[model samples]
Target: MTATTIPTKTIYAGTGRRKASIARVRLIPGSGKLTINGLPGESYLQYSPNYIRITYGPLHTLGLDKEYDILVNAQGGGLTGQADAIRLGVARALCNVNPEHRGALKAEGHLTRDSRVKERRKYGLRKARKAPQFSKR
Candidate 1:
């Protein structure tokens, strides 16, 4: 008997981190729609460009100027941070889904992991950047 082969599906997985927040994502090709546990997107839609666009920036990349419907579960971030984290997670997943899209997303710096974070204040410093009230004698 001849050997039969089945095509493998491309799947992408990525994690998003910002400050103390993080979003884990698994992406598959489908009608874009975002569903976040208790909070329905209807209320959060205004917060995010789109379910999948959160990370892909689908509108910017595809240039369709529209958002896709997708399901998402995010935690650890505020409305804005969660949105950003979701975007990161989704974008990373997109890279795994298709290698070709990497260039497009990377060009926009979406794929790059955001390393910037709040700096720790040093001893005798009121803040990370601000020196304790300087008083000249």
Candidate 2:
């Protein structure tokens, strides 16, 4: 009988939300690589510099952009919201990797989750805040 051993390394996880989007992130020690929902980060993000930049904000601020691989499973909202959520998740995972990172990530504002979301449309209104043209008749 032969026994096989699997190498174990520390894995950090975090979850973030923005608008209707949610991102579950995992940080693994390796060359910088990003995979989202089984797709390459760049391809999934449509190679947008803005989005790519946003997702790497925390890592860049901490000078660890090339020190870890990011794997994210994101769902719901649009790409913008998903991008923001990923940023927050990455920041949080970094914190889990090292509590001391909280201070720096917080200072960079990457640890903050954007809480703004579309307001639910009211039953009596055409939209969340808009009502049918004022009938001043």
Candidate 3:
């Protein structure tokens, strides 16, 4: 008699960054569940609908929101930046699962990493470009 073995589902990985935030994302074949830094996505994001929407934008765009589970580890920056970073990470992971998703994700701008960050303060500036109070005696 011959033995048959079943293949396990594959896991896809991707990294994304926005401002000072970084996210490591994983996509696996499962229900539409999301976890961030060992916590449920909603709880971690403070139950904000906008954060949830931003984090799931890529999957929604490709109509795969309920097809796979997402696992994310994010750090640094604020909530918004972390959400955007997770979005890009998810988009990249989708592309990894199927290269054909690239065009769709790209068209939706999910594949683009936001590069905007806070400007550094100069020596003579109060903050970034803000000047100190002028004293004209």
Strongest candidate by lDDT = 2
Reference-based lDDT, each prediction = 0.61, 0.91, 0.91
Once fitted onto the true fold, the runs of candidate 3 whose alpha carbons sit more than 4 angstroms away are 1-7
Error of 3 at 61 (Å): 0.7
Model 3: weakest 10-residue lDDT segment is 1-10
lDDT per residue (tens digit) for residues 1-137 in model 1: 11123365334567777666687765544455455554555566465455435544733674523334334677774666666776777666666555677788888877776677778988887889787777898
Q: Which residue pairs in candidate 3 have backbone atoms (N, alpha carbon, C) closer than 3 angstroms, thus clashing?
A: none
Compare candidates 1 and 3 on lDDT and give the better one. 3
TM-score per prediction, in order, is 0.67, 0.92, 0.93
Candidate 1 ranges with C-alpha deviation above 4 Å: 1-11, 45-60, 63-69
Give the candidates in order of lDDT, highest first: 2, 3, 1
* Tens digits of lDDT, candidate 3, 1-88: 1112237867788889999999999888889999999999999999999999999999999899899899999999999999999999
How far residue 113's Cα lies from its native spot in candidate 1, in Å, is 1.6
lDDT of 1 at 45: 48
- The digit string of per-residue lDDT tens for model 2 on 1-137 reads 11122377667888999999999999988999999999999999999999999999999999998999999999999999999999999998898888999999998899888889998999989999998888778
